[model samples]
Target: MLLHVSPARVGFFRAQLDTGRSGLVLCGPKSLQQARRLRNTEHFSGPLLVDPAVYEVRAASGEEPFPDVAEGTFGFEDPLAVSLAEQRAVGVTAPMTPTGYLHAEDSDALKAAVRRVAALDDPQVVFAAPVDVGWLREEDSVRQLIACLRLVRGPKALMLGGQRDPLAQHPRAVDHLRQIVTEVPGAALLRTDLAAFGALAAGAAFTAFGAGSRLRHIVAPGERAEKSKGFAQSPHVLFPELMDFFLGKTLADRFAGTAAPVCGCAACEGIRALDSFASNAGDRQARAAAHNVAVLMEWLRTLTALDSGPARQWWWYERCVAAVAQYPLLNAQLLQPNGFKVPAQLKRWALAAPAAVTVQPRADAKDYGRS
Candidate 1:
């Protein structure tokens, strides 16, 4: 239940922190100064991860020429140097090395990155990669990456980045993620969306998603920016029942009935109707974001309480099944001709076989990264 928010939007999460349910806060490079200030001055004690976002710089093509972060933008030529700077700035004990998106065909680069990171000799280091989703779909690529990952003596994390949503494009993305987690006992999935919950059920060490749409998925190099120039973007409201997010205005239009769905999260205080989130009021948008985090945190707590692997898997499976069942009735209520299609990822979760339940002892810092 990690929440990824930009520096500007971090204040909106005060309500979430007050509950003490939020796990970790992840922000991009630009947030280094603010994050450090919060830790030193505000006395905020939660774990804060400042991602260098080197992947954005590396993923850009010659035409784009570092579309997001240009060379020397942060006064460092090496991306990992930028990440190390963030670690020092925030005083994080466990450091995560900055990495770039590696394509499936580039086995040489993958092995090189793994070997280089392992040479750092930091047992607490987190070896992370922004991987192309094609690797998940290709068995050979998954095997190759997993083998290389085994050589690194540290915790490993993968971020699926591309032009389109990996979970939507690759039907077996969750299955592949499960395989990786099974092979690498404490692997993490970062910068993801609802699919992360499935990863948790599959025994992933950690998972994170953005507070807004832009941070939810990592865009590949050369992909066109989705945001239009002048139009103001509306916050996306998460529909817990449907297990999907809809634009605030779109959700409002769909629930034209007298009673729209209502959220029971602490942020909403069990009184805010779903359509109310569509309002243009500034406070309403913040409330909507808070509501989203509350719902996710509550679900995470519920799953964690079900201690055994089998129990968690069964609980998540049933939840996905229920969400899939709601689409047909929702379309009928809206008087639309099947306008909504169940998300492929949700459908996969409902239909996939439950993974084998195993009990593995937690790996400590000393044991982590050992081949």
Candidate 2:
């Protein structure tokens, strides 16, 4: 997975590079000023990307401006107006209106959007719409993606905005999503949010997530947003590689029981030994961000080095199995036996590792998919 860096988190990327960690960098900010600042200060020379702050655009359309719509955004175009959190500055796109997924029934609009973006100076333009995972289940999911792929002429990855898990967890969903991947074999796929990591096993080029762990999921989120922000922000811990998360825990809880010593990732080793907390939100968030990136980097390196689909599959499967074994909750929810069937390539690669591994079925298991 490529490390998608924002202007605010350039340090995370630089720190990883300075320490000899490997990852592909793609940089940009929703604002031209911030993007310019990142280019000038961070010396980030990678391809500039358009990070659509889709959250900035409210879904309910009306003639009046949204109350939360960032100020100063009155004339900004699609390429210019993308920031989600802050008030708009002069020339920024005003009150982005969240246009729901048009690709479902409006292929003409989707193509027009693609062609319009293809005309931009940036190497890649993220054509993201606030979409639910159910779009994959639509009859035309394959056709819709292929239509866009046909029109994209240059170096670019098509981003499907939405958390990938709800659709991805189901067997039919994988079949549908994988069809798009298979048909558009050369197209680069970008899945935003924490679930993006899961796409790697499904054949996406990269899985990108935002800075700070809390900003991880948005589309079809199973739960509500964190509602407990008070005068002081609590410290947090996350292990992206291990698929573990512990939010708003006290500093003392970090080292307690299985949580102590933190993650063993090289990135974590550097910060895990520190105070691990700060009264300031930025400091605490930055700490958690480092841990999250470190774990992801470790997994990225390991996955890339595997160098064979079957070998990669075998490795992924083994780690997932081990992870579920260690984190009991995962057994109930992730990489379930029913959701997996040994692909021909993976089965061939399975030979590289020991064959003692067997997927035994439970007596009460629902036949969620082929085992």
Judging by lDDT against the true structure, name the best candidate.
Answer: 1
Alpha carbon lDDT of each predicted model = 0.69, 0.44
Q: What C-alpha lDDT, on a 0 to 100 scale, does residue 87 get in candidate 1?
A: 77
For model 2, how does the per-residue alpha-carbon lDDT over 1-371 read when each residue is reduced to its tens digit? Answer: 55545656756535554233233332334445654554576555544343443432342122211123445656543322243222233122211222333323445545554555456433333334333444566657557756665554443344443432344333454445455554554444443443344456546544455454333434322334444344245544554423444443433333333333444655666436423543445666665666666666666666655543444445556655444444434323443433223222222222223224343222342321111
Show pairs that collide, candidate 1.
153-369, 154-369
Task: Give a tens-digit lDDT track for model 1, residues 163-186.
Answer: 546766777777877889778856
Q: Which ten residues in a row have the lowest lDDT in candidate 1?
A: 362-371
Residue 164 deviation, candidate 1, in Å? 4.0
